[model samples]
Target: MKKFMNEAGSLAADSLDGFVGAHDDLVAFGQDRKHVRRRVLSPGKVAIIAGGGAGHEPMHVGFIGKGMLDAACTGHVFTSPTPDQILGAIRETDNGAGVLLIVKNYDGDLMNFEMAAEMAVSDGGHRIETLIVNDDIAVERTARGTGRRGVAGTLVVEKIVGAAAEAGLDLFSLKAVGESAIAATRTMGVALKGATVPQTTRETFVLGETEMEVGVGIHGEPGRSRQDIADAATIASLICRQILDDLEPAQGQRILLFVNGLGATPPSELYLMFGLARRFFEAHGLVVCRKLVGTYATSLDMAGMSITVTLLDDASLGLWDAPVHSAALHW
Candidate 1:
């Protein structure tokens, strides 16, 4: 509602323009104008392209750079990119080694990307594969029986898979790595305040001053439950427990812990949550092999955060630590 923009329907496009300009060092707007690709790409390495809607910053777009996605097709806020846009991304990023698409498990995303992949392969004569990330432990099915909704774990998929693609892995191997990453990951989020889309003056959802959604999705979707806001420790415990229940982490098992801000949550709060998460890990006898804390994936100005735990193996560990140069994450 209280956003700075030129117009309502044009927010996504205008914001993308700013995004493209700011990350000019690493990204360029595709000819189709609905996607982004790395400035420099390997001639014959497996190219990785990840995309979804626009509000989740430092996600598909922010992860476009060295050792990551070669292209990212962005839709409007919380919407799926069209098949034509996705096809354009496939064509542009496909090197001699082919291309891989990392899409969340949302129905629209799945359908659109699949259609685009088919179009690219049968019509464009390009080889393209798709990896669907469904690591949200919040729920197994929504009202539409669309299976699990993808959340922050999608970022984990991009990181490990991107590294493998950069290492010249074949298309099949790269897809396997992505699937493995998704299998090893689980995420849960809580929203203290709802977000307002740029097109409307109303918030996506209403929350009482002292109430919160215990397990929120990135698109302002309804979470599992709503309750009075609790302390950081309690909130962190609930999120960790929900994800760990699904993950079933073993004693002394290693994990890559990520505490992500949902746009409006501050670093101070996220670090506090991370501290509590670490305490919980210590109490559970789990070892955190790597730590990533920030707003890597975010809703549109939503005051919340998500916790993602990826049980890392030797291969994932090495790839997770691999060098990455991107807009949102770099190491």
Candidate 2:
């Protein structure tokens, strides 16, 4: 309810315009400015396009730059972009080489992006392959009947896949890398409080000061349980354990540890949780080889965090360390 906007319904469009204005050197707006693409599209490069709702900033958009997404479709708050909008992005980026669609596993995103792919090919016969990210260990299915929710792990896939694209990998090989990244990554999150979408008058969900929702998805879908909040270490244990046990990688394996704040949680707290996660790995013989910590993915002003673990071999580790320059991440 309390948002700093002149109007409500136009949040996505208005915010995207402001973003283009602020980071014009890094990204450019499509005809309507609703679609975002890299300022300079590489002709021979395999364009990586991704989209979803708008509440989660710096995702799908912030990652739009060199070594990340080539184009991103911005939708209304928690709503999928129309086929036409995605089609606009696809046409803007494709240049001889094919385009890869990196979609999160959600009903709206799945359906809309698929329709957009068909429209893109139908419009001009461009080749497009879509990869669905379903790395969340939160639940097998949500109310929308999608597979597992795609949470923070999607970022790693974007980075690795983007790096592969930049390495001049063909579309088919790039998609294989993306799928491998998705399979190797796992994510879990807990919400101490719910987010209030800019378009909505009420918070997405209500939580008591001393309560928490475990296994939360990015869009504030109901998690597996709502119970009294626990300490930071305890919280890290439960979430990290579930992720590690489910992954069950070989002992002494190296991995990337990404800890993300929902929206309002501070770096101090996120790092605290990150430290606890490292400790857990150390005690269990897993190596915390490379790590990215901060608010890479988030809900709108929600006070919580998610921890993502990606098992890394030489190939993924090299791609993970590949230089990246984007609004949210820069190296």
Candidate 3:
């Protein structure tokens, strides 16, 4: 129940104010307080914009900079930004080439971003394209009617495709690269504890000290099951198995492994999880082409980790290795 600020009534402008002051070099708070996009500009190149809720820090906004997202719109915690906010970002970041929206496959995000795109095209006369990322294998067979949900793996797609856009790739090519990256990525996560929304002042879910929630989504949605907490190695194996099964990377296939912290999981634990993931890949005959382990994407202070494996070819690998200078992620 302990929290610092009021989530419901706390204006998005207040949050952006603190963020911009803290990282002036990395971001510039837009004139419209509701819209916060990356300040870095790339003339003659297509701009990339993506965003959703606020709690997923360093995501849509943090990725804004030289090599990642051109702009990002932040909504309230766990809620999608309004269409107006998204449209403002498009108008600000769009150059003559075009603007691409990297939307996660959530109902609100999809709908709101789509509406903004339509508005941008019809009213603003801007060329707009959209790509939806749904890489979470945990919800691959969701009973909620839809298939998989987008989770931490979205960071991978944004990084890869953002690089392509920065490299002067056209809108069509950028969209193709984004879709390819999403298609090649698969993710699985386990939650140790629930996160407290700023406004609620209480944890989203109750879990016994010895229990863990497997197959969790970022929004504190109920996971597939609750089970007794196991060793780090065992947890990593479970996550890796799901990712491998869904991705089905062949022997000798080069891949990128991301051990992402949900929010509060320590780096020490993440490294341990990475070790288990490495062993799993080695056993499966898959080569770890590149590895990134950290809290790249998180769900507030939720204690959990998600592993994303991107099956990569030369093009994808090159795109991934491209230099990126962002607030949350660099190089």
RMSD of each: 1.3, 1.5, 1.6
Name model 3 segments beyond 4 Å from true. Answer: 6-8, 11-13, 141-144
Candidate 1 structure lDDT: 0.89
Candidate 3 lDDT by residue in tens digits, 24-115: 88778665676666666879999898889878876777788888888888888899999998998888888789999998888999999999
What is the lDDT, from 0 to 100, of the residue 302 in candidate 3?
A: 94
Of the candidates numbered 1 and 3, which has the greater lDDT value?
1
TM-score of each: 0.97, 0.97, 0.96
lDDT of 2 by residue, 68-109 (tens): 899889788888988888988888898878999999988899
Reference-based lDDT, residue 226, model 3? 91
Question: Model 2 TM-score?
Answer: 0.97
How well does candidate 3 score on lDDT at residue 319? 88
| Pairs with backbone N, CA or C atoms under 3 Å apart (clashes), candidate 2 | none
Full ranking by TM-score: 1, 2, 3
**Residue 314: error of model 3 in Å?**
0.5
lDDT of 1 by residue, 161-220 (tens): 988988889999999999899999999999999989887767889999999998889999
- Native-to-model Cα distance after best TM-score fit, residue 86 in candidate 1, in Å: 0.6
